[model samples]
Target: MSERVLVPRNRGFLFLDSHPAGCRQLVADMWQACPAPAGVLEGDGPVALVIGSSAGYGLAATLAGLKRAGIRGIAMSFEKAPTVRRTATAGWYRTAATAEIADTAGRDLVFLNGDAFSDSMKEQVADLIEQRFDGRLDYLIYSVAAPRRTDPATGAAYASVLKPIGQASCTKTLVFDDEGVAEVREVETGPAEGDDVEQTVAVMGGADWERWIDHLAGRGLLADGFATAALSYIGSSLTEAIYRQGTIGAAKAHLEATARNLNERLGKMVGGRAVTSVNGAAVTQSSTAIPGIALYTGLLRGVLGDGLVPPIRQLAALWDQLTGAAPLVLDDEGRIRLDTWELTEDVQSAVAERWETATTATIADLADLDWFHNEVQRLYGFSVPGVDYSAAVATDIPWPDHAP
Candidate 1:
């Protein structure tokens, strides 16, 4: 009983491996079509840690900070498990269906998988937040996307590329599968020579997000008004010469200068804040392994149709700019753009007029590549929606009663 197909790899998409009740019915139909986070908070809430929490936009900001700000999550991830010839990584059944839906809503999670740029996974997430989160954290969300990195004190490995910094360019790409848009080419890339933008800024910069906020702000486990963020992307200007001036935009401009030196050392030691945010352009899995970013996310989802804002509505507009519902803008270098409505100006002037008529016979009539192939088959939990993909299920599920 193993028929969960959709592989098309060369670093773009992969699935054929995942079941556990169809990845817990796509994480219970994405938190039953997630919503509740416009505003809500009533004391003793925040905890979150989330470093690359299993899947895109770090699993939608770790399920919008534990189902919309009732915070208390821990997450981390490297992924892949199930055996006897595979079936797991749909982020290990989306972290065992986010610990069986945060233990049936009595909310609390831990789920660390490993190698979160190791330092023994930051002292195993600061000893599981000092044995079950009382040692304090408030929020730290880094959202890593590895390709290679290994310098936990000079083990020196580093590898991340995706060329285009100063020469060969071109554009228009699509050619996907898993049943959708199998055409549209042009392609070129090639650049990022020599120390390839310093090994893709030592494998996607922000130096392991300032070494996990300097080891959770030196283990006194950071909390006093604490807040930290990382994710970044610049988009538009037609993937500015292969993504914001290439080499992963010089590793997102050294992760926006390591989020202004982690917001001036977590605001002079503990009034805390270290933002960066940015994000937009959806279909993740590290933006479909980037090369003209899946034809600019299928012409920016055909110019933001349904005002395109996935990644759980951009992590609920970044948890409504970290709970205030406003006043947390920042841009001219102070980062946090949150893709300000995916860079409006009429969504980059209707995606630069469908990027000069996208080709391969007008990309299925101008891009949306079937909503980028059903959002890469709903990021590999397989075209979810009340599941039941011919039921055969079970492939060793369990693991996540605060897994570690």
Candidate 2:
């Protein structure tokens, strides 16, 4: 470990650094709050592979599985390792801390830090699965969110954009600082141009999810009663044009379509199942990057207050549904609907009323802007309750050596 002190450096809403102890504390807190599964899932416990399992809902889901049920997991993500000069990404610290936590409970969490979208990485995961945790996987969770993806077959790169499709969109969004709500402005974005939608879909859509399942199936690595689910979102009409009907929306549509196809494919392979879960909005790194979501989520938090189901709760509910503790609550498209509480008629009406009249002057009253800042800060391991911000921290935490 390098002897260095780290504080969160903000470039607008994105954080430049992460704290290792705070990250561990955050995971420990989530573990403490997450309840155990009501019943056994797929046997005593499942060996799960969580692609993109470092942050947000993915991390929440991973923790839920580990604490609620005895899930020995393999996670994959591409996070920058720390050097003597620069600190590691938040995900890197999060993954390391979680592995350490897992060890105390006698649970194993093997992490493969590499490009999850590539065939070579998939091969590495397969070999590890075969050699380490029994040669079969019971559960797979796809939760990758990134701005760019390179096609493994053609070596072509595609970058995803968060812009509207078909028509331009303009809306009110928040721009804030550590103090409180700084400004509220109308952010306008142009429609997707040539190849924008396609590229975004290629980067964010279900092609990779299909690829993972196919690779695992081809290798005869999928266990009986196998189940897979990919996380998704269908936003409210408050920011529909720029979100649910935008370039990112097209990618989500393709993802849902792939889930349908994979549902059938998994059934044929091992009498297994696949589903896409439409989760509620939380202040994730991906959600905060969208044009007008900052304002929306703040208002949402204010209106919903304690009523809003946190990501960990929602994920734990998902685990229960998948494991027969409860029935799956699906929408018309056969996708799980965990966003129901977030999109309730009462909640949306309150938020929409606030959206119409919220200005820089009244944003504090109309929205939980400070809460948004706090959540965003917590995502990068700052703003945590028990962390020592000014003290010297061991910045360069090494990834655990868990080779199979």
**What are the per-model C-alpha RMSD values against the true structure?**
18.8, 1.7
What lDDT would candidate 1 get against the real structure? 0.77
For model 2, residues 248-298, the per-residue Cα lDDT tens digits are 999999999999999998898899999999999898988988978888898
lDDT of model number 2: 0.87
Among all windows of 10 consecutive residues in model 1, the one with the lowest summed lDDT is 2-11
Question: In order, how many clashes per candidate?
Answer: 0, 0
Q: In candidate 1, what are the lDDT values of residues 12-116, reduced to their tens digit?
A: 475566556655676676676668755455664778888887788888888767777777758888887777677767888888887777777666777877788
